[model samples]
Target: MDAHRKQRQAQHPSLTITDMYNVLEKLRSGEALSAKEQKTHEQGLVSILLQLHTELDAAVAAAYGWPANLPEEEILERLVALNKERAAEEARGLVRWLRPEYQNPQGTQQTEIGLSTKTKVAKATAKETLAWPKTLSEQAQAVQRALQLHERPATAEDLLYQFKPVAKPQQGQRLQQIDSLLQTLHGLGLLRKTELEQYVK
Candidate 1:
């Protein structure tokens, strides 16, 4: 089973467990599937893979101290709650570092540095939240700042959520504006666009 999973992952590195879950749900609902999804279904792999997906989800949920069969909405709610709890703990200088060796290499000294860094990051995040730039150039710089802070490639929509528009445009117009800003940054060689259409510095 592990070998099969590794093989599948190698073949489709971008295929996520959530994608498989959605495909299975669509199948159960008799909804029309996309061409790729239809092909997977025709290959008779959906049911087989879905069983593995379920087992994986159950194991993950158990590790998180959650029920094995939580609905997606409930899972999201729990995640948000946990995130808030962690944030509060962090504010109180209690950090649960995922990688102590890498994040705090110099022992107690590094831990102090990490806490100080987290405090600065928290302040920066609070200041940036819902505070959109007024000019296009400022917005471009803001995007760069956001990318650096996240330390990962982001979709335009992901970056869009980081700020509130100074003047609310229609949804479609707002998306176009964001795309244009990304293109401007790309042309200026300030950012790079991935094959997945995400932007990074």
Candidate 2:
């Protein structure tokens, strides 16, 4: 039975609140995490965040004693808003930027949400294929260092300074790749985004 449980946990990482908190602390401390561990952490964190957002889902909400009937969007909004408040109140970190991907189109693209930005957002180049940080781990390391130096969660905007020199993204490509890389790192658990934004590990 123990072996079976271990196997199951190996297949599906635990999603308990304690597990979530541990991962958060690990990321907050900028500990080194393997790609696989990072992925697991990302999945667990997202599950916890989404679970908390599913206010109407009894099974998920029951854990937090959150009332049902609140919409997912509202819950998500509340989480992001609260993080912003906490960051400002405690100097914990900055929020992620959720760009309006659909502003030019008529709902053709997903609306940017739950992302973060820095005090100033650097723009991606208008034209360029891409370049820089050859591997995910390399990128992740950069962000982690940035977080430690900054002593706060890092936004893509903030990470730009840390990675751009290494990437040497030419004038044409500019900040495009860094932005996408930040998202990738967030997805891989090398980095994290609060409800709607990405922050460095």
Candidate 3:
């Protein structure tokens, strides 16, 4: 604050508290000063006002028993402890952030679930998920299309092999779904399964 006030004094050599009050009174009474002097005068007033507000905020926080500063380690430890306690309370359906009147009647457990930073949305419903098809029939059609494009029967593992330029990537994790769809297609007489090989009809 002192440095700022000194800087302002250097900028406006004749600036003073008396000068500021007189200029403010003149402004209030609809009198105008040169634009450059008015800017300098306002800067001086604003610098003092900034310091005054800063000191007032510190005083108010002190009056309420708030510390001005805390060690970085202490802050981190407090945040971790707070998060742990909040998690425990939330698990017991004691959510405190939401209003009592506005709390979900079905349950807060579901509302609070999947809120952790590490939590995912089950991959399929991820926010960045594309419109890559997922229905039983759609997945079966995908397998059939892959087979017909190859123009030959393909083994279960071969069908699982992803062709490039395909909208959806390899169904590596979803081999079970792919297998199920193939079985359903075979059951519906849309596909022919001879040994481990599947043929599109």
Best-matching candidate per lDDT = 1
lDDT of model 1, residue 186: 61
* Candidate rank order under TM-score: 1, 3, 2
| Candidate 1, superposed: residue stretches over 4 Å from native | 1-23, 28-39, 42-44, 108-201
For model 1, what is the error of residue 109's alpha carbon versus the real structure, in angstroms, after optimal superposition? 12
The 0-to-1 C-alpha lDDT of every candidate, in the order given, reads: 0.59, 0.46, 0.51
In the range 1-201, model 2's lDDT, one tens digit per residue, is: 234334435667654445545655566567877775567576564344443333224322322223455677988986688577656744643323333232323434331221233311223332322234454434433434454455466666665554435535473353554565555545433344665574634
lDDT of 1 by residue, 33-134 (tens): 999777555443567766655655543453344567788899999888878877988799876644344565655432211222422212235346545656
Candidate 3 lDDT trough over 10 residues, lowest sum:
120-129
RMSD per candidate (Å) reads 18.6, 16.1, 25.7
User: How well does model 2 score by local distance difference test?
Assistant: 0.46
Q: By how many angstroms RMSD does model 2 differ from the true structure?
A: 16.1
Better of 1 and 2 by TM-score: 1
- Candidate scoring better on TM-score of 2 and 3: 3
- Per-model TM values vs. the true structure: 0.39, 0.27, 0.29
User: What TM-score does structure 1 among the candidates reach?
Assistant: 0.39
Residue 194 shift from truth in candidate 3, angstroms: 1.5
